[model samples]
Target chain A: MVAESARENKRVLEVKNLKLHYLTSQGAVKAVDDISFCLNRGETLGIVGESGCGKTTTAVALMMMPSPPGKIVGGQILIEGKDIVPMTETQIRKQIRWEKISMVFQGAMNCLTPVYTIGKQMMETLREHREMAKEEAIARIEKYLAYVGLSRDVLKRYPHELSGGMKQRIVIAMALFLEPKIILCDEPTTALDVVVQAQIINLLKDLKQQLDLSFIFITHDLATEAEVSDRLMVMYGGKIAEIGTNEQIYGKQGPMHPYTQRLLKATPLLHEKVEELAFIPGRPPDLLNPPKGCKFHDRCNVVMDRCKEEEPDLREVEPDHFVSCWRCRES
Target chain B: MSENIFEAKNLQKWFPVRRSITDLLKRRQSYVKAVDGVTFSIRRGEIFGLVGESGCGKTTTGKMLMKLLEPTGGQMLLDGQDVTHITAERLKTYRREVQMVFQDPYASMNPRFRIRDVLEEPLLIHKVGEDHQERLKMVARALTEVRLQPPEEYMERFPHMLSGGQRQRAATARSLILNPKFIVADEPVSMIDLSTRAEILHMMKQVQRELQLTYLYITHDLSTARYFTDTIAVMYLGRIVEMGDPDDVIDHPRHPYTMALIAAVCEPVSGKVNRIKDVPIKGEVPSAQNIPRGCRFHPRCLYAKEECWTQIEPELEIVEGRHWVACRRYKEI
Candidate 1:
């Protein structure tokens, strides 16, 4: 109980009832509907879901980007005990963005400016945020490059000169150059080869420990998430279906939500051998016009009539474990 | 010989790199040895997996098997018939007996055409049936074979109307409509979602079983390769470094590259995060154009010795019952 209180005190980021919608021609696409979670200082919270599950939308909302058609409808995003939802655009730009939180995008090829050299790109960020002199920024960039295991000679090279793994490390270094409280990594290793991917994951873990940085790592791969995250959040459609400790989420017969359970079973494990994998029968529910009750009701194996009529709240079923299924609550 | 329906003997393909004016003045020539002396044979109904990383030439090997790209050296046999020296007319017949399913379903199909046209194009080209109505019946049967039930619903829909999985299934249906004996499916499930991957793989397996079609399943994912293939071959730098039972190769890898590949797979299991130590090598995959001397993996091999750099190319040696490895330290390992 004392440890739990200490963790609560270390809450670096808390998202409460956050709702983001996309104003499309057909209707208001409820991309993120009433999702809430807290990220403890130095802790990695992994958000995992299929395509169109609003995982990326939640990350973008945290970044406060003015992506057209996507707007934050409501909710409190409290970072360091201060509500950021009501902050002015200039305040968000000057203080909240990059100073507190930054994002590492999916593909490194698209993220890095093609025409600019590595040193020039790093200097732009440092100069804009810290107003550091060119000489000082160059020195800082060299130091950051060393931290990410890149040679200072890479500073002279363009983005195309670097490999995918090197480009990813540079992107991470840029995100960390600001020394933000939290870093949002959206599928950082999706495009890399397996060996390169392992190297990146190890690098991320090392950086987290050395810097005491908190991470909101988002990926569709659950196994990759298990490697880094302290807690796991499983989202289906637009709502979070389950959230719990890594052990509670990935333990033997641990995932309580049917969608989470099926997802785990569907993934092919390297060590384990099974006759066949159990796949979720139907596709993810249409977010443009979400279902009436539970978003996963159509695919839930143990679905009841009540599931189709009433949406179950995310209730704490066990210590530090939350599930949004009435059957799980009863059992 | 009777059971071996498809055989590739020391297949080789070298892609010539584009030369600049400076190189032309200097009279310099360079080639990327994409498929360097690859040899394998697939049984009549076996799923032979060619597993490797991006530049390892697995896709090139698959393309060669489908005759989409001609090999610069060696020969291929279909039903004990030599295809390398076949006439254009004979090659067309050979192509009819072989088909290919690409990696990206979205890019492989024609967006403007309906599903019916996509499936019927192959039959129309091969002159499978006398009447267009007869070809439509064949299309329906092929669609049903791939589990795209109620074919009438999907027949009129364009490629954009279907999901990734549905589009891939339609591609598979189109490939099977020609009644090919062998099919090269290159990363068919890589682009789809995990939940949909198992279903598509199941459909492919079922179609292979029902039609007695041989498969050359090429993918960079080792876990899926192990789950899908019967006999697995691990490639590194355009060469087949290891070949054996998928379980044997993946569970107890002999080659350092294969070991590294298996160790690198990020599993979802807890406490297995730090399971892989040292990654068995250093640096990223080198460009295929500048492949290392001696063993292609010599630079990255953790067990590389002085002889590894200067020694002649190591040939694949049978280590155990049909398990082959091309490592110099195969005995010590």
Candidate 2:
């Protein structure tokens, strides 16, 4: 029990049955339905799925802001053993958001104000958080900027003056300014070119090791996810399809879930010569009117009749590996 | 007749930059060298991929071929006939022979029109069909070609009602309604979902094979370029840095830029997950307005030498059989 407690202490964040729903005029859209996962200290967890698969919703939920009409219906978001589900927006801003967990949003480079210099916007973030001297704040900003491989000269330049890669770096630098334990990056390198994307990915990896920061890296790009993530979480229809280590998820044995297996085959690999790439037929499920049973049953190739009637629970298939599939459960 | 269907000799498109007040006072003129000098040829029924980063003139080259943008200089030969300065009736005929599928299917399509109307409009423009009934049959045939099944069900639906993948298929159908011998597809699968990207590519390949149509596939994605195209040309700073078989150019890249691009691709294999990649290249692509005097890629190249920037620009030269590299230090590198 003592050893278990000690191991539990190493966990930075633990989510239990997290459910985020977007209440529409039609009905309540279960964007993130009853999903549970944990992020360990100094570990990078990659959450990957297709568009509208609730990956971004989960990220927003973790940050305690789930846009309008979306709410954390039920669940315990335990950060360092303290539940943050009931925390108010002001409370989250003061104590949790950016102070303990920060986020680098998709296309965040474009979010940088065109009217203001990069330094001015970063300084505003610093000023809003705590009571620090202007000199000290500037010094901190410069330190973080250097961490992201940018010089002090960039501080004087506006967002328009910088390239896409440079702007992304600046956004990453700002994410690190708070020195948060966990950073949520959503498609941070999607808009970038192949070479520039590699540079940014390398920079993020370097920072992750140097700072021992935990990350929730979300992207639809499987290859990029493989490069950075220590653990992989495949989400489909706002539910956990499979969660395992890189080896377990991408190993020769392959993923347990049908969706994951197909998704892996769908991605084109550079090293391997594939005669024909596999593709999942049909579109993603509509959250407003999700299927009766397993969310992926409509598209799953190995789907049984039971899968159309009952959703399977996320069960431990191996040590540190979890799969939510009737086939795996039956096996 | 030669196997080559389309050939471009030193194609160039230089857009004049609006003169600033300072430049106006100084009596200076400048141009954004969008496509300084690009040269390549597409075979009779081969998918020729023009791959590059954003400002590298791949799309501009495609536009020049599509005649969407007129080139400032150079020659374009279609089937051994010079069509560079063709006007009026010849241009319309060129349009009929060479169709273009744009990047965004969502934006390219008219939201107000049904899928049938979208496909039929092209036929009407080219005056390919005799009447509305004949045009409808052509539209159905085109839709069937792209695997949008039953044709009748999808014909009545608006663009907004179709999914992204379906819309892209519809766009492809629209491009094929005219039965063009050549299709200039600019990043056709980039905007679609990951699961559907392969499907769209597969459909396109099947269509290309069935119809024996040539394609000028322009995209920044090297992986898709490798999978989809027979020949690949790596473009850099308004020039063809490398051109060869898709496998040769991608797997055994001769040019430094191509090497960097291949190195940067995050392979999805499980074995390579833990491998830490040292990004071989440095800095983003330079602006086209102020291209370097010698080699444009000298600023970011790891093996760059003094002569790379101070000497005359390198031109495409044969490195191996059917493989070409433009770097002066290709042999040394």
Q: Supply DockQ values for each candidate.
A: 0.60, 0.70
Q: After superposition, how far is residue B21 of candidate 1 from its true place, in Å?
A: 3.8
True contacts kept of each: 0.51, 0.67
lDDT of 2 by residue, B138-158 (tens): 899999999999999999999
- List the candidates' TM-scores in order: 0.97, 0.98
The digit string of per-residue lDDT tens for model 2 on A25-61 reads 9999999999999999988899999999999999999
User: In candidate 1, what are the lDDT values of residues B1-333, reduced to their tens digit?
Assistant: 588998889999999999999989999989999998988888889999999888899999888887788899998989898886667888788888899999999999999999999999988888898898998899999999998889988999999988889999999999999888999999999888877788899889888888888999999888778788899999988899999988888888899889888888877776644233357777778888898999889888889988888998798889899789998987786
Model 2 chain B: weakest 10-residue lDDT segment is: B267-276
lDDT, each prediction: 0.88, 0.91
Clashes of 2: 0
